[model samples]
Target: MTRLLIGALTAACLVPAGAAAAPAAADLEITIRNVLPGQGELRIALFDTANGFPDEPASTQPTLRQRADGETVRVRFPGLPQGRWAVMVLQDLNGNGRIDSNLLGMPREPYGASNNRLPALSPPRFEEALVTLGPQGAQIQIDLKQP
Candidate 1:
């Protein structure tokens, strides 16, 4: 019995501490600014991977739609798993639920990406707009652009 007790105690001591603790979820807050005065909806997308980033359809990823109240809009995403993420915003002036493009296939309305990144020739890549979220969470700001 004494030998059995010693062996059990030894095994217990070998186990690492805090192994059962799970990581906490993170909070992410995004603020979109410079939105043109209009009566429409603001479409926001949060992407965790580059597979289907800013241009992905609504069915494929997480998205939020909010009314365009003024020049600025704020959104909060809480309890998100800790990791890297990117953001995209579209100001749907016509409330068409989609971005309108001109003959050249260029966006006709204002849009924005995380980090305020605007590409001159092509769409912004995930790497250019990545944001890291930790236990402390993160807060970001994006400014709308028109072309």
Candidate 2:
């Protein structure tokens, strides 16, 4: 028993410092409101960085995507590490799997960002819509802007 105890302790100490277990992942719940009467599904995206943030309404790539339709939509992102995250929502009014935009590059369909922030003449940046997820996770609400 004494030898077994010492061996166990030695093995524990031999573990590299960098090999420590990762932090527990948390869940993120997003509630989107102000969904206008439309004919297509909603495309919601979750982004962890500024790159491709509020990506072109037609962009096919996003960290995460969910299709929903309603005056209020709720989606869950489970097992996400506690940190900053940004969300962008597009009301795909044409069911084309993307948001339509006018010639001036303004979205023709309703859209929104995390924190309910929208910048005029341009898309909202990641930092502009950042939300912090604590160890216990977080919940946020966004309101869409109509064209």
Per-residue error for 44 in candidate 2, Å, reads 1.1
lDDT of 2 at 7: 100
Clashes of 2: 0
Clashing residue pairs in candidate 1 (N, C-alpha, C atoms within 3 angstroms): none
lDDT of 1 by residue, 1-147 (tens): 999999999998998898667678998999989887666888998888887777774475668898888888899988888888899999999988777888877888888899987887667888999999999999999998875
Native-to-model Cα distance after best TM-score fit, residue 129 in candidate 2, in Å: 0.8
Local distance difference test, each candidate: 0.86, 0.80
Q: What's the TM-score of every candidate structure?
A: 0.82, 0.87
CA deviation > 4 Å runs, candidate 2? 56-68
Among all candidates shown, the one with the greatest TM-score: 2
